[model samples]
Target: MMDRTDRHCRYFLRQISARTLLYTEMVTSQAILHGDLEKLLGFTPEESLIALQVGGDDPARLAKCATIAAEFGYDEINLNVGCPSQRVQSGNFGACLMMEPERVADCVAAMRSASNLPVTVKHRIGVDDHDHYEHLRQFVEIVAAAGCQRFTVHARKAWLKGLSPKENRDVPPLRYADVYRLKQEFPDLVIEINGGILTLDATLEHLAQVDAVMIGRAAYDNPYLLAEADRRIFREAVAVRSRHEIVEAMYPYID
Candidate 1:
């Protein structure tokens, strides 16, 4: 959920399910460390199962951001290592951080020390010209050692210098095999595969090999996909409602 961290996306997704979890966009450490604290952490506690996504390389600053996020009642705090935007890469965060596993571990450790809620990471398999499964394994090893067990990996390599953010997401092919290999190696870790996942069947198929599957664009473009998640994924049956009924219900909130 990259830009879905925005208020509109958050509200829209919330309307999809009262059960499915939601994540905020990647807010950098500088914004939380130096910018307005309230605006950075401010969110309705009861809105949904909200998680805060913080982007940065500084351990202390990430820890501070985690503390603020937890205090604001975020269900969890996640570190972003998957974004491939030039603006993010130039700032020394996002996918580029995959090259510095030890630093990522340090940041995760610091965040863990600051909050009781679960600390997780969202990253890419590898970055730029160096695309190797071993690189991702080493990163998982180092960060897991820091007590960060939950991870979400966009199943692709990020071309930091040659691609725009949108291009980075589309141009690079998603390699689910690399991510599944990670799960095979670290059976103890909870791994979620992202990128190019568009349908419940796809997500469910991947879930057979990994701990979870995160759908981004598909979930947003066709939100009704999630309307059935509670029943299909969680195995909790929700009373069936017609599409017209759903639309009529949304009328009150449309304005």
Candidate 2:
């Protein structure tokens, strides 16, 4: 979701579904440590229930960033291990970390110790030839032991060698069953499924197997789909907003 789920995009989505948890784009630990803190981390109070996603391999730097995110009022601190971009691979983080579960566990442990807020992780099912359920289970088991309770699994394996980030997202056939099996084995863990979940009905179907479902590209492209989220997902007894009402609501901000 890098460069996609910015403040403006999140604000627009928030207007559609007040109850869906919003996450910030993956901010690198280097940016959090050296960049403008306000510009990188700031958000309106209206964007509450937001999780700040950070990308890095260094435990100390990640811990510092997590502390800063907590101070900046993020409800959750999420570690990103799903990104497959070459830029991310060069940094020795992202999907490549799937091969090093102990290191990821250390990063998670450090962040949890540094921040009082909930610490979570977003990762892919596998990487390259390691697309097996046991591999993913082991990765989760090691990380979960480090006080990390929640995991968001993108139900696709990452191809680190040949595919581009965009290609990795589409070419790798989605194996949602792997995610569902992960939840069955680790019933104590909060497993949320991601990747290719386009509609609310599809999301609800995934939710039947996992604890939650995350909609990324679909949500951003067809944001109005979230208009019914409050009623359908949260079970709120509220009226759904019309597309016209939503546009009207954004007028003041747009102007």
Whose TM-score is greatest here? 2
Instruction: Give the clash count for each candidate.
Output: 1, 0
**What CA root-mean-square deviation does each model show from the true structure?**
1.8, 0.9
The sequence of per-residue lDDT tens digits that candidate 1 reaches over residues 57-150 is 9999899888888778888998999888888888899889999999999999999999898999999989876788888899999999999989
The lowest-lDDT stretch of 10 consecutive residues in candidate 1 is 39-48
Q: Per-residue lDDT for 1-255 in model 2, tens only? A: 888998888888888899999999999999999999999899988787799999999999999998999899999999999999999999999999999999999999999899898999999999999978899999999999998899999999999989999999899989999999989999999999999989999988888999998999998899998999999998999899998888888887778
lDDT score for candidate 2 against the true structure: 0.93
Evaluate residue 95 in candidate 1 and report its C-alpha lDDT on the 0 to 100 scale. Answer: 88
List TM-scores for all candidates, in order: 0.93, 0.98
Q: Candidate 1: which pairs clash?
A: 5-25
lDDT of each: 0.85, 0.93
Error of 1 at 201 (Å): 1.0
